[model samples]
Target: MQIYKVGGCVRDRLLGRPVKDKDWVVVGSTADEMLAQGFRPVGKDFPVFLHPKTHEEYALARTERKTAPGYHGFEIHASPEVTLEEDLARRDLTINAMAEDDDGNVIDPFDGQTDLHNKTLRHVSNAFVEDPVRVLRMARFAARFGFQVADETKLLIHQMIANGELEHLVAERVWQELEKALLSNQPSLFFICLREVGALKTLFPEIDRLFGVPQHSQWHPEVDAGVHVMLVLDQAARLTDDLAVRFAVVCHDLGKGTTPADILPGHKGHEQRSIALTHALCERLRVPREISSLALKVAEFHTHCHLLFELSSCEVLNVIEGLDAFRKPQRLSQYLLACEADFRGRPGYENADMPEKAAFQACFDAASKVSAAAFVNEGLKGPAIASAMADQRCRIIEQMLKPFRKNTGGTAS
Candidate 1:
């Protein structure tokens, strides 16, 4: 059996980037031959195994044919006759279709090297549109490498989306690609690519509808709600590698997309609308609880976070309690980061000063000292104890954050 290092490892190595994981393609081998070599059979639908010692995935070279609709419609044919080139041809992009021999020789059967040098994500063949999931994968690759999508590939993805391919994609697979892209260096590109081909409208209409929508010019200088969201998503990517925070930023302004036409740029009480849309999006995507929880909270109160300096101490305490910061301090940390992204995600606002995060954190720190345990010790119970604690926290926040009180209304500093 001949084995070759294939796919992302090859692409990343050629691009002078760090390779995270290695996938091998074994040509001229069968499932029995692999087992004879003590490779553990793990693939349910195809001939794939794990190396006994290295435990790296080694999939036998195979070809796939569409048997039905959706991503699961593929029928795999793995055999000794399946050549390496045929296997590479089935990959989503030219950059990911390249491979390397054991002697460190790259095998570029489809001019992947040229495309890589040009930083272009082109498909290897017309078969690129066979699977609906490629629509999301292409966008994900764009986000990961910041590479330009080839014109033909864009057309092919559009063809796929236009023919209801996106409608057939599994929600889990869509979220998988989205989750990975959100953690990428240029995550906004993922959604941008999707929107370019109209797949965004089909798959995530909540997000896609944001593109042409107007925003309050005074607050969002970019004036387009969708552009604002992309900026926020990219800002979240820059601030940290936290997926929840980035995902929250993505959903924070979804309500703006559904604003009344007459309202134009002014979206009053958009947060409440945003919360409902965010909940629907989370439910549709089957988003993980940890991620969706934060998304919902950010949707509900991100503006509140922005207006922290102008808010009364009681309001500040409400934000802290709403986030349950005392119990899950980590939530507050992530919440603050997402709010900062929103605050700075506007044009000419990326470097603006945001004092709301720090002041609110200070408020939380001082108010956290007003413990329920102390209230309980005073024979307070249930709602009475909660009210007393809320009052004390409000007082502490008022005293602690008084100096930052201003009419900034969380706008760009």
Candidate 2:
């Protein structure tokens, strides 16, 4: 059997990027032949094996046919007769269809190298629309490499959306792609790509609806709610690599999209609306419990964090308790970051100083210092102990934030 390196490892190498994993396409091979050669059987739907020593995946050259719908609607055929070019043609993108021989010879029958040189993301063949997941993969690749999708490919994506291909995507697959895109340096492009192709409305309508919505100009120089949110998502990526924090930033403002049109730019009481929408989106996407919970809290209390200086100590304590910060201090830190992203996301406000971030951090730090052990040792029991601890925590936080609260008056928004 002859094997050639293929897919991401080849594309990344050509772009001078550090290759993380290697995938090989083996031609003139059968499943039995791979097993006899000490490779471990791993692929469920196709003939894929693991190298005996390196344990890297080596999939036999196979071509797939669409059987029904969704990503799993595929009929795989792997045989000795399956040519490397045919296998490559079945890939999602032109840049990912190239292969490399062991002797360092590059194969480019699909002109993938040319697309790479042009910084373009083009489909390998018309068969690209067979799998709905390619739409997300294309957007994710754009986020990763900052490559523009070819006009023809973009048209194909629009067709996929029109023909209901995107509606078949499972929640798990959508989350997987979204999580990867969020990790990229410019993840905003991923959402923008989906929006441009109308796939956002099909897969993530809550986010898609945010595009034409307006926000208060005084607070958001970027008046479009969707634009403001994309800026926040990118800013969160810049500030921290924490997926929870970044995801929180992505969902923190969903309520603004659903605001009453009569309210126009003023999104009064949008926080509660955002909280409900965040829960629905998380539930629909089957997001992990930790991630969903953090996102929910950020959506609910982000306003509290942004308005920390204006809140009384009791209100600040309420915010802390609402976020469950005393139990998971990480939530407090993460919530602060999400709120900071919102403040910095507006146009001309990218580097503006947000005192509320520092003030909120200080409050949580003070609350952390107050111990339940102190109240328990004082003979308080059950709910009494909790009440005493809350009181002490509030006093500590209040003492720390006296100067800011004094300067900024009024109740929490």
Instruction: Identify the candidate with maximal lDDT.
Output: 2
Residue ranges of candidate 2 with Cα displaced over 4 Å = 261-268, 373-379, 406-413
Residue pairs in clash, model 2: none
TM-score of 2: 0.95
Model 1: colliding residue pairs? 306-410
* C-alpha lDDT values of all predictions: 0.86, 0.88
TM-score of each candidate structure, all chains considered together: 0.95, 0.95
Give the alpha carbon lDDT tens digit for every residue of 16-98 in model 1: 98999999999998999889989999959878899999999999999999888889899999999999999999888888898
lDDT of 2 at 216: 69
Candidate 2 lDDT tens digits, 1-413: 89999999999999999999999999998999999999999958878999999999999999999999988999999999999999999999989999999898899889999999999999999898889999999999989988888999988888887888888989999999999999999899999988877788888888998998877656674568899999999889889999999999899889888878555332346877888999999998899999999998888787777667767788889988888888888888888889889889987888888888888888888788877787788888899988888888888887878788667764433
Best by TM-score: 2
